[model samples]
Target: MDYQTLIVAVDGKVATVTLNRPDVRNAFNETTIAEITQVFRELGQNADVRTIVLAANGPAFCAGADLNWMKKMAGYTHEENRADAAQLAEMLHTIYTCPKPVVAKVQGDCYAGGMGLVAACDIAVAVEATNFCLSEVKLGLIPATISPYVILATGENAARRYFLTAERFSAQEAHRTGFVHQVVAADALDATVADIVKALVANSPNAVKEAKRLVQDVAGQPLTAELIADTAERIADIRSSEEGKEGVRSFLEKRKPNWLN
Candidate 1:
């Protein structure tokens, strides 16, 4: 599908979705949000695409909502605003729950709603100098739509401080808060992200996808009998599957697995 705000390119087993509105620092308007939701959903089901990289083409990774879009929203009634917010929520959900692994390549400033995109990715890597902020409170607005994923990325304590303060934090701070998985120097950012993508692609495609879903499914759940049984059932299902048998057989036979071959 064609996109006006994104550049989608597939290279072998990996697909890169770069936010392309550099003129606006890749900010999200309704068009951009809709396109993001549609493209991610498409890539999730594309058998040829095993992993996805979410990147941007500007000085800022994303600057949240576009100014013109904000101007339009300023005139929206309460119900209209809820409808608009729901779109943004769904866009974030698409990325968070995508069947394929998503690695966010955050190369610059990630502010407000942009941080939501970062939080939704399965793995996030940022440059050492990259900045992040949840600056909605400053505008008398709240980061409500992105809160679920953001809260999951950064725990409640970190969220409480950042949400209320709306302060700008460094890449290191983001890593410390567990929002970003890795932070590297600007020069090393691409290499670091590439290595992660390589590792992701090397794993069993089904296992990788299932592992991601497992974490999303089991996280924050109390360790009850039902939870334990569910986990056991999941393991049993995968262990008896075609990929599982091949994985074990390949290791014992000292040969590359069919996936690797």
Candidate 2:
């Protein structure tokens, strides 16, 4: 699918969705939101695509809402604002729940709504030179739409500070706060993302998807007997499946798995 705001490409099992609006720092308008939602939905269902890389062009990863879009929002009624916010919420949810593991290649600065884009991904790799901020408060707005993701990426304590302060933080601070997984030099960004993609591609596709779902389903849930039984059942079910059988047999035989072949 063609996108006015994105560049999508597939090479082997890896699919890349790049934010293409570099001129405006790849900021999201309503159109950008819609296209992002559509692409992640499509890529999630594409059997040929195993891992996805969320990338951007230009010097900044994403600078939040497009200036023009925000200007348009200024005239909107409360109801219209709520509806507009819902679209952005849905867009983030799509990427967060997507079955394919997504790697955020944050090459430069990410702020406001842009931070949500990174937080929604399974893993985020940013350059050491990048700066990040949750500057919504400065604009007389709050990071309500992206709060769930941002809070999860950066703990509640960190969120309280950043959400209110709107202070610009360095890549190191983001890493220390556990927001981004890896922080490396600018030139090492591609190689770092590639290594992660290679790791994901080598894993069992069925298991990988199940693992992703497992975390989503089990995280923060109570340790009840029902939950324990559910997990046991999941492993039992997989162990008897064709892919599971092949995985074990190949390992036992000291050979590459069928999925690799």
The candidate that wins on TM-score is 1
Residue 131 error for model 1, in Å? 0.9
Candidate 2 weakest lDDT stretch, 10 residues: 211-220
lDDT of each: 0.96, 0.96
Q: For model 1, which pairs clash? A: none
RMSD of each: 0.7, 0.9
In angstroms, give how far residue 41 of model 1 lies from its true place. Answer: 0.6
lDDT of 2 by residue, 1-261 (tens): 679999999999999999999999989899999999999999999999999999999999999999999999999999999999999999999999999999999999999999999999999999999999999999999999999999989899999999999999999999999999999999899999999999999999999989999998997899999999999999998899888999999999999999997
Whole-structure CA lDDT of model 1: 0.96
